[model samples]
Target: MGGEYELNFSCMLKPYKRVLLKLSGEALMGNLGYGIDPGVVEGIAGEIAEVVALGVQVAVVVGGGNIFRGVKASASGMDRATADYIGMIATVMNSLTLQDSLERNGVQTRVQTAIAMQEVAEPYIRRRAIRHLEKGRVVIFGAGSGNPFFTTDTTAALRAAEIDAEVIFKATKVDGVYDADPQLNPNAKRYQSLTYGHVLAQDLRVMDSTAIALCKENNIPILVFDLTVRGNIRRAVIGESIGTLVGGFCEVS
Candidate 1:
């Protein structure tokens, strides 16, 4: 599909009014293994800029696995809720860094938090978020639903549903879904596309069960793609085939 619609039997369609992109904080870690990497962030922002140039309304929710993992803190004897709160704050850090990078590149960005901190960022309000989208401003939701024990994956589903996004784009290191961990299983078969029921029944690790169920219930598709591949974000947004589409009936590759 040469940047134009193709009538191929396996072509992916892009009729979405809006899209929610879920970025893992680890994706921004570059080679440091911790904290934000300016180069990586800029590359990611550049990809978003390309998508935005296509007139797509984008909303992003970034995880904080780059800064802290609540599960890890719990193993260290911290209260789960306290540890989760710390994780939420970590996400806020990523959201700020992303917003700063996008702003520096002339992309109007907003950082909304699940936990209220009026002086720093705007509190997440669905209507306000939609308004921002309508105005072509990219919104980054941070702080993970203002609750504990829920992963940022769940936050992406919840916000995507609330915002009426047609699909949830889950960007990861891998380009698509596989039956087993690609790192562990050298012969693992990669799925070109998968249905919601198939994905749930097989217990795929693309997203948490709660998030997958939420997206399934709301008829929102999840596109799992490799964002580390420069320009994949724009490709995914503009209907390029770079990942596994998780929703609807299973289609053979």
Candidate 2:
């Protein structure tokens, strides 16, 4: 742990100027089985605040799995399109809650939705979103491309491309990607870095195929790291070799 801290500190020399963070709704659940956990959201907000303090522009795309999962509902016999629309609304709720928490932390924030809801959030405008980040405001994108078929992962990739973020930070429960599920396989190997083709060929599921292909086409690197660890966001932003980097190389440990 001490050595890890040293490495993280030493890598602070080259922080990214702009980044897109992908946070799953389940991550906001903490120990709860469902719904948002205020404490967890507060902790995440604080960490993002630290990154903003470093002058790094941050944009977030949050998932809605905790509140509602469209794919599951669709599998259960509901109309796929309707279920997905409901899922999008769930993401909006999450975005609002996150916005509230971020504002409480004194970090300026903007909630932009692909599906326009004038009463609550601004409509998704690429230029305006970029302007918000340039002015030191954290932008939260919700509603998943304003369509039923696309997942939030795809939305993250799309928004990242539109804003020209330097990198995409995929915050997950696990520390990094592995050859097998570490929980089930004691001998599972963790990958330190991977190439785009490798991820798709192996069906690693780092992100959906659409999202991965989009990032690949846009030439954006993705760093998959453990968000549960305190300060991991800032650590990643500072370029610490702390997660599975998916772009331009392949290595496993």
User: Candidate 1: minimum summed lDDT over ten consecutive residues — where?
Assistant: 1-10
Query: Which residue pairs of candidate 2 clash?
Result: none
The residue-by-residue lDDT of candidate 2 on 51-133, one tens digit each, is 99999999999999999999999999999999999999999999999999999999999999999899999999999999999
lDDT per residue (tens digit) for residues 1-253 in model 1: 1111111315455656699999998998988978989999998898887777778999999999999999999999999999999999999999999999888878899999999978889999999999999999999999999999999999999999999998899999898888888899999877777766677777888799999999888888888988888888777777777688887433343
Q: If scored against the real structure, what TM-score would every candidate get?
A: 0.93, 0.93
Positional deviation of 142 in candidate 2, in angstroms?
0.7
Give the range where candidate 2 is weakest over 10 consecutive residues by summed lDDT. Answer: 1-10
**RMSD of each predicted structure:** 4.5, 4.7
Which pairs clash in model 1? none
Q: RMSD of model 1, in Å?
A: 4.5
- Candidate with top lDDT is 2
Tell me the whole-model lDDT of each prediction, alpha carbons only.
Answer: 0.86, 0.90
